[model samples]
Target: MKRLLFIIALFVVPAFALEIQNLRVVPKNIDAGNVTRIMFKLSGPAKLSINVKGLNGASVTSLISNVLYPAGQFSIPWKTPKKIESGYYIPVITAVDQISGESVTKQIETRTAKMISLPFTTSDLPGGNKEISYSIDKAALVSIRVGINNGPMYKIISNWELTQPGAYSVKWDGWDGDHVIKVDQLANYLIDIKYIPVEIDALYVTNPKNISKKTIVPASEILRQINAFVPKYSVAVSNKKIASNSKNNESINLDINVDDNTLEELGDIPYEYVLYIDGKRYGEIENTTSPYNWEISTKNLSKGSHVFTLMICTSIEQINTRSFKVTL
Candidate 1:
């Protein structure tokens, strides 16, 4: 009878309910150039999308577009913004059952931790009013002190000056302990930054070329109202082109003479490669192990095209993409 009860218990029961649980943001204090993973468990098959939003209700990166999946554990990886200002953010997870349409929304608070550190190496000449510049990733309370080379200790120039998130210079009118001094008296500079994370949602990250930027919140909405004493330049954007920073761009050469752009294979074991043309995903190269190659036809494309991207993805996390200006 005990054996019979044990066998009956072995026949497990499955949950019919559809929902996502145990959602979490790994290493909540994000850093520069790190991958942030969103993890969760599903009770049933569903479609889900994950996103990060600034505290001001502005949507950051849409990490995962809506996709269907089976009931299981999942951890989706996303490349965190390289120059994200230290602030409060939220990871939003939304899921919907494929059959029943039942859905659930979950959120977890995440933030960028702050630290006191030396500024990047700088050398500036002293004038009538000397300006000392520093580049910071976020808004910080700055304290500037100046000292002479082989002379006296550092003296306080400015204390607790709230500055914006970009590279701004602090001006010093050659003062020594609340008294006027000559510009030649200045020799060395010591600066310290104190970070206090903000609960802002909306901001823009712009690149130098303004191409491939990420906006946690749109600029128009965030600038609608300016509260009293808020740091004007607390948020910043970057101008990074997506094509130049790929690690898996190494390609194999081929002897064949073809007009179409040919893609190279992995190696002895031809790993499956997926291609993207004009920002849209095409099919994948099936299983095989050889010096395989493929090309895309540009005959049907418009003439004198300016800019587009050719990207290739593999099973690994690193992706390769090339941007070009074609005149066809």
Candidate 2:
């Protein structure tokens, strides 16, 4: 009877759920060209997945996906991507017990986090009389645009301008392209910024005529390639007419010509052109052969003057804009 009781007691031990503890991200404030480590403890054997996400809740990268980890302390090293945007990031970890169908999810504490501070401005003026200021944490391409809410972007303060880490300020004269912005207009501003990285593989693969194949590429040549990455394009319309006839809804032919004429000239980098009308996105053409054409429909537009803006952009952000008045 004593042996039988001991066997029954052993079989009655309840199973515990999956658990994670002591989660940490070392070197919370990662610098450019640095690596971070994620460390954690598990109570029992489980499959785990770890991912880093930005402040906007977008997954930036995944360290591991559903990999089995033994019941012990584990550490994961993650090297920051060369072209990662400057901002804050959070590490999310998940663990699952296969047999019990139990799972646990947790994020690192805010105190122990990764962050890259960005530029900011304190003044807000509708008349555009105030000076916009920002601090660049690293060398980057920056641009600024201002416009009324849900209307045409009237002024472009900068266009893919190379800037170094420091404090910078620029004042706006409150001028829309044609005239001074009115006091009643509610204008909005956009600061497009992105860091540039030296891409050797891209240069080799693209085989741009400007950059010759060599075992070692000089810094000046690399800088030239970086500058070429900024999109230089021109916009043209076949007829520049909103409607061929008022009775029917007709589309107009729009063409965008890349100044370089060939993708190889730009290292075959991914890019796109976005068309905006009255501050709203109209159409977009992503990485494709040159001579991008889009059909702009004028059926919904009111019979008056409208702003037609063509913006060139890359994975990072907008590089340049070409805006003009189109009267229907």
Give the best candidate by lDDT. 2
State residue 246's C-alpha deviation in candidate 1, in Å.
Answer: 74
Per-residue lDDT value at 161 in model 2: 47
lDDT of 1: 0.48
Q: Give the worst 10-residue stretch by lDDT in candidate 2.
A: 198-207
Q: Candidate 1, 83: how far from true, in Å?
A: 2.6
Encode model 2's per-residue lDDT on 69-186: one tens digit a residue: 8898988888876556554557789999876868899875321111123455746666546677877654444546566555444555664444445687777665553443332254
Off by over 4 Å in 2: 1-117, 122-128, 135-166, 175-184, 187-249, 261-264
- Give the TM-score (vs. native) of candidate 1: 0.32
TM-score of each: 0.32, 0.41
